[model samples]
Target: MDSDMSMHASYAFKHTCWGILLLFLAGGVADCSVVVTVSGPHVAKVGSNVTLNVFITGATRPTIVWAMGDIPVVTWTLGSSSPPDILDPGGVLSIERDGSLSFHNVLLNYSATYTIRVVELGVGSNTSTFTLRVFERPSGDPMCSVTGVNGNQDLQYRCQWAGGTPEAQLSFPVLNATSSGSGDFNLTRKPSQDLNGKEVTCVASHPFLQRNCSVTARGPADFQPLVSSMVDADKKLVITIACASTSLPVATVTWSKGNQILTSGGRYQISSNTTLLFILDFHLNSTELGTYTCNAVNILGNQTNDVSVLGPTVSDLGLFPNQEGTMVTLTWETPRTSVITGFEVQMMGPSLLPSPGGRQRRKRATNEFGTIQEKPSSARSTNISGLDPKATYRFRVIPTAGATRGQPSKELRAGPGGGLSGPAIAGIAAGIPCGILLILIIIALIILCVVWRRKRRQTRYPVSRAVEKVVATQPNLNTPHTLLTGGLKTSAGPPDYSVHLASERSSTLPSVVSPPPVRMATTV
Candidate 1:
């Protein structure tokens, strides 16, 4: 039995050796070979077309099959082509019996990692993996622009764009990333004045042959300097304009009449202190009248200010007391225009009130013509003869010359309707209250002095008065002590039996003969 078992083992071992050799030989040859794989993109967008390959060839063609996300695409075999058939239709995929796979109008849901396998009738199947990914194109309006950072410096923004089945390369102009595309960007740009308000654009590129996406940015318009002025009668007008603070941008300042531009040759005259953004002063003469517009401008913008210097502002208008009458003394020193010829001093009141509106041209006057006009010193004192002490009137000296004639000077006095006229208010109304206040002050001073003196005496000599009253009750100096004792007698009781007193003589009163006994009177 043991021998038989050994013999059986020997045969089994020999058979196994033969089987291994046969397997090795069979691997080298086959009836047919299968090769399955995906052509086209590994990651594809939805609604797309792709070719899936499943080739079976060695001997006779075998059946080939394909599937996407669990849905079968095709199942066929191309052998002698017994009968050809078209299985799946539009939006789906298909494959001929020959093992050629085609995907039609794909959807996002169709996207997946697909497995393609080919089988040679009796042989096993071979498969390959394919991954699909879907993405959309980008869209929007993008642009670039520039704004002022300082006087000479500007900032820029670049807008960029792109469209594709996936992220693609986006091109943008020289600009800050802040405006670059619709995605991640950073502000990075330095611009010059010439680049300010300039236009820029961006172009996007994608792999497929599609129209490129684009965007552009145009920026900050030109800025005009804001101009302003303060009119000064005794000095040149100080003109100030607002402008960019950095880079010291240059500016040209000018003067004009009304809205007409002024030139050095024209009647208009102007002077400036600064050629750039700054605070400056401009002088205007009496001749440069009407509407004085100070203009400031640069390459960026321009600004104008219209200052109405109507007339010669009168200073020091008064009446000098004179023996003949009141002398009208007036000074023409002020915001004088070259247009003023001189002045008219007219008197119209005193039952002869001429101009109630303070504008009576047909009144009496001492015509005064000015000399060395541009100089304030030339507008010194001018005397005019005028009478009427009890009458009240509004007085004014009008200026006329150059453009000064077109624009009248400000009113010197609006009359009593506006201000105090003549001596009526100055003498009766104002002076009376002042006089009353002075009298009351004097009376109060006298009363205060009396009260102060009385208080001082009480503080310095409080007991002296009481001692004098006691001394008055006694008579002679023969016994001054006795006399003092006599005053000690109480009105309600007899005198005390024992009493000691110290005698103190005042430096003012004599110690010799005394006066008769006299009681000091007291009252409540």
Candidate 2:
């Protein structure tokens, strides 16, 4: 009986110990519902540093595992280092004591979903996940192209940024863009009048690349010059020259006289609008009268215009010999009313006078009748006398003004025998008679034809003429006498009195017999 009681006591004590151990184990397991916290970069650039951390709340120490798509990359234990499970071979990855993964230089191949598992002692495992994306920096510059739009009134520019891991951004004064692969942007605007020669810029911006590009528009292309000279209000000789140019990039205009480039200073003055002008007080040197050039230069090309300063000219000089053969008269007209000093008229004839050096000499006022150098005259005509009767002559005139002498007038050839040679005389004589006879014949034919046409018309449609009859006793006796004319028949009735007599005739009788009405036939 004593042995049985002892055995039963031992069994009950053992059961109580086992029940306590089971309750403790159950409480520990309930405390192990771990809430995991993850913190790290979700995106990283190639060649940049990144860190991913894993933590379990309310746990002093834990075992952690870091993996990429179920493949373990790093593992750690509470009291010692975890087993080596390195996934990156580039020596760029490491793990921290707090269960954090680090990369010194991230690579493109490192991009994947990374999951971290945290386990506390006697606690359950908990997991947190992060997706990492790796990208390379953009490269290269932006390129721009321009084209004309709206009939060249507006310009359309296109800019492109290419060859980047991630696309870059492109921008202009008028537009902007965002792209992931490559960027192409366009802008269009109407250009102002002065917008030629202006610059347009394109800017490209990216995480790792930034650049700018520019271009210049086309410009002016051609030019022309106009030149004139006159005496100014100040009585100073003035010359004005102007240049006009056609260009897109506004042309730069310059002036040059002879071999010297001209600027705005002293006697030279310059001004511009669309037309560029250069004015100078006249200097009568040979160089001053040389060719003046206007040059227009631009990016596209260059153009030039040239003109020479010269004197006034005369025209219409003529000479005619009189019928008496005593003299020849010269006539000329001035082209302009500019200052004229005088005119020099010269004549070379069959009977010529020889000078001392065998060279022709300038004749004085009294030297010879053939050459006449006179003061300016109001009458443009002049007569030359003392010419030998049967000699030929060539006459010309030159106009003089200030210090300039104009070119000689066209030569006029005159001589005896009605101012013509033998052949000219014969032609004139034969032509004049033929012309007059032809005119006379034409007039005679015209008159004869007119008369014949009139006669034919009268015969086709004849008209009647009234006839008057006078009696021998008409002055003493007032009587009515009717005259029958034409081939018409007349019927006389009681005297119809409608005849009117002149007041100058005296009527002795107050009433008299009246004339009868006459009827005429119509002719077709």
Candidate 3:
């Protein structure tokens, strides 16, 4: 037993000696004098490549060693036969005759605390360490992107990058854009297609990279899709599909209900190709209501719309006419589709075209519950009243489905009052009297002309010879005494003064009288 214990003790001592030797050797390896620094400057960009240059000017190349943190880097020993060099995929280390190291393609991985060691028997060996800091290359500038754009709008471009090897130039002309460093690049282009139907590409030039790279954006194709948002209206599911596609464009349309393979049913009706409208109506009263899935299959791609139906629409439409007013009442069953919680009532006149301004009547009905029309199968009926007399009205019932809430109905015509014949008709019958009055005026004018002609002829007639004889026998004149005073007037007897002075005034003119010497004695 004593021999065994002594042997054990000897073995333990030997192990201790070996451990001590290893510790001393490890410490000697750590003892060295070296210096390391990042090349160019203390700061570098995160993305742009940089080189790490280390200088050991005051020390010999044989005594110096370098490491990245705890990892041992290659060492160059001047006396060794092996080539004094190290190679890292990130960059190659060139050992300069002056004992400096040059590393190219410096990466973020190179960033960290680095230590350099050097030892030459004289002057205690020393280690110099440095920290490599990398800041994120300025969030690689903001880039602009456009998808599914159209001719109505133009493509816009702008760029902003930070932390590049050389600061980016924000003032350069877009037509002659130039980029610096490896970080971010952008382009502004007016992409126009060629007649041969090839995509146009825009190129960006890199000043630092010494090369040009191209980016291609898409433009117009043969088939285009314009899908209308979904809605639940009427008693079924409704969706509108309009295409601005450019080909002879005879497209086959197929609708699907979710993963459940769709089948053509009574409720689906497509408008004539000339009209370009399609409708699917599932007259969902209580029993026939259920959720529906719709898919529009086109050349470009397939669009899917899922809608749920809910109620038994109670629709009431009645017509009434009275002395004063005519009225119509419409009531409908609830809808059986998702998102159709209410209804929109539309009344049209001369068939009111949907507003050209893209407007709907904009009235709505609401449902308090989140109801999914799961196999609804009942009918529902509403009323409209106070319409003008004898007027004709057209009505249509359409179901709302999916996203938008309403659908229009087919047109219906209603005739109110159909009132009595017009009063102006009697006035039209009295026109004969006016014509008779006109004729009477014409006859009166003819009679007046005849009377005027007769009067003019009578005034132009001559008198008889008997009137002339009566005037001749009335008086005679030629006496001188008659020429003075009263005697001058034609008289049968002379004036007294004229009779006394007859002889003296014999030279005066004589007067004449009627009864000249005896018209009565003329019988002799």
Candidate whose TM-score is highest: 2
Please report, as a residue range, the 10-residue window in candidate 3 with the lowest summed lDDT.
367-376
Model 2 / residue 512 / CA error / Å = 99
Clash pairs detected, candidate 2: 167-180, 219-248, 219-249, 220-247, 220-248, 220-249
RMSD of each predicted structure = 30.1, 29.7, 26.1
lDDT of 2 by residue, 1-524 (tens): 99987876675455444433333343335344677777887778899999887666766676666767756666556557445445454788788777778888888888888877665656565667889888776555788766666655566667787656567777775333432224787776565544465666787777655788875555554544555455566766666676766554455678787788888788777775424554545666675666777787654456877766555456688887788655789999864323344677887765443434677653332323254556462448788765556665677887665456678787777664436656777999899989999999999999999999998876454333431333332454354444434444455764333432443255565577775654555675
Question: What is the Å distance of residue 267 in model 3 from its true position?
Answer: 7.3
Q: Cα deviation of 37 in candidate 1 (Å)?
A: 5.1
lDDT of 2: 0.64
Candidate 2: Cα lDDT at 122: 65
Q: Higher TM-score: candidate 1 or 2?
A: 2
Give the TM-score comparing model 3 with the true structure, all chains together.
0.26
Give me the overall lDDT of model 1.
0.46
Give lDDT per model, in order: 0.46, 0.64, 0.44
Which ranking of candidates, highest lDDT first?
2, 1, 3
* Candidate 1: segments with Cα more than 4 A from true spot: 1-32, 41-48, 59-61, 69-90, 108-111, 131-136, 139-164, 171-186, 194-203, 209-524
